[model samples]
Target: MLGRQQDEHVRLDHAVIGGNDLSEIDDAFDSLGMEPTYAGKLENDINHLSQLGFEDGSYFELTATLEPGQESPWWDVHMQKDAGPTAWAVEVTNIASVVDEIAERGTPVDGPNEFGRERPDGTYFEYELATLGTKEFGTQLPFLIEDHTPRSNRVSTPTPSVADTELVGVGAVVVGLGDLDDGIEVYRQAFDLPEPSRQTDEEFGAELAHFPDTPIVLATPLAAGNWLADRLETFDDGPCAYLLRSSDWDRTTERFSLTGESSWFDDRLAWIDSERLDEINVNLGVLSP
Candidate 1:
């Protein structure tokens, strides 16, 4: 399952990177000119995820667990084993239906559970998710988001800093795993993503996956060898890739310098200045402290 894709597939709806290095993450933000919108917390049975706000509803989550006392899905495993991509959450219209569809194929799933961000009014925006698929699919299965909440009224408003804040979000995510080709096939049959081009490197391994639209791209290494490889090997086949955005690298990088530790990277993708990005627009919302 670690080779070129045979069919075409669509883009990823989003991507999530999980790591335990919060301080390093903060330091990475300092390198950027702006600051990260410190999203509070998302508590589940297994992981503790923190959201960072951006101009649009789009944001990247920082995840880890309190402790590995129990069998957990995210942080505990990541800390004990190794860091790697561990879930390919699909965007779906109906969580239950999607779960049923994948489960019929014998994939294990978790929620039509209500998940989302809390709006200023104290109302929460939510979406349903499916379970991770079976061992053959590498368990990259995750719930799809039918409703995506905009971070502000000016979600589309351009930022003065860039003068042209063109790039919206993660363009591609490169993942390193065991059965790259098999996972690619699962994405194709499930999401209808375009077939992908192939290549390989000794250190990185084989890659077979498609680039989703603006916002999220997914790539998987053919062989699971390094630290990243081990995570994919354990997390049951999810995200272990880096993100791509249609942004001016230099200007964005400069923001990293301006902001400080509010931003960070997981050796992949920039946690762009979300607070700064939203600052460009005239309208702002004040939620409770």
Candidate 2:
């Protein structure tokens, strides 16, 4: 188990969407009225781009392997499963303590590995990541990251001219699970997430276990006809969707229409189909001002 608890609270750093079709995914984001604030190449093997500047500090990262056969092990595994919005990352203040905690729990972690990328402006951004979920647990678990530099320096603020729709923060990350109890046990042991309050959504035909203190929600299909069930059937159990909060719901919906990407929208929520989002579900909901 993790060592004595530190004073830091777990916060989401970013969510990753990976695909081989870089240009297509880029175009899709563009069509959805989102503009990338920063772009960079990782080790000349992967391309990384971000649309940041959220008031709440969470960001979205779009990444793709540069070469056909020379993909990293992580990207290769994600692509083999479904390839879009594959991994999510959490920010931890003490990297070594977090790493030690996982190791002591019998989960062999790969790093406190340092990595960096060059910004378009020629400056470099560096950070250390401790990878927890591996071959044993599968790639669904989020890795822990600590930045050496200020996060604002790495992710710039989005201007109104560049961003038509405002993404305030991540409301929840929807994790698909084979067994709800097993999934809860794993996340609790790894991240110290609290016990979830369970509920059933009749509209989605799914049962949800909400961990209100954290940014994760565990989803399991009650039957075979719902969206969650279909996803669990097609892909391995992992992160399947992200519920993003919007600053202005109406304005965001108007922008969505301008993109002409097929999406479903109500007054409070919008669901962008996976076909338009690199096979990952993007749900946008309104956040109260």
List, residue by residue over 1-289, the lDDT tens digit for candidate 2: 0111122545777777666655555666666656555466666555555453455666767666665444555656554443565677778888999889877776668889888877778877888888775532234577888988876656764534344446666655667777789878877777666787776656545677766556676778888767767666665677766666666666666655322222222114446543466443444333322
lDDT of 1 at 144: 52
Candidate 2 yields a Cα-based lDDT of 0.61
Model 2: lowest-lDDT 10 consecutive positions:
258-267
- What lDDT tens digits, residue by residue, belong to model 1 across residues 1-289? 1111111122244445444543334333333421333334444545554333333334444445444344455445543442423333334445566667655655455555665755334656555544454542222544355554542421222232223453334344454445666766765555545665454433333444443232222445544465446545566555555343433555445434222211111112233334532222111111100
User: lDDT of each structure?
Assistant: 0.41, 0.61
56: Cα error in model 1, Å: 6.0
Model 1 misses residue 140 by how many Å?
2.1
Off by over 4 Å in 1: 1-13, 21-24, 43-48, 53-57, 66-75, 79-88, 96-110, 115-123, 135-139, 148-167, 201-204, 211-236, 249-289
Instruction: Supply every candidate's count of residue pairs whose N, Cα or C atoms clash at under 3 angstroms.
Output: 52, 1
RMSD of each: 10.1, 5.5
After TM-score superposition, the amount by which residue 195's alpha carbon in candidate 1 deviates from its true location, in angstroms, is 3.4
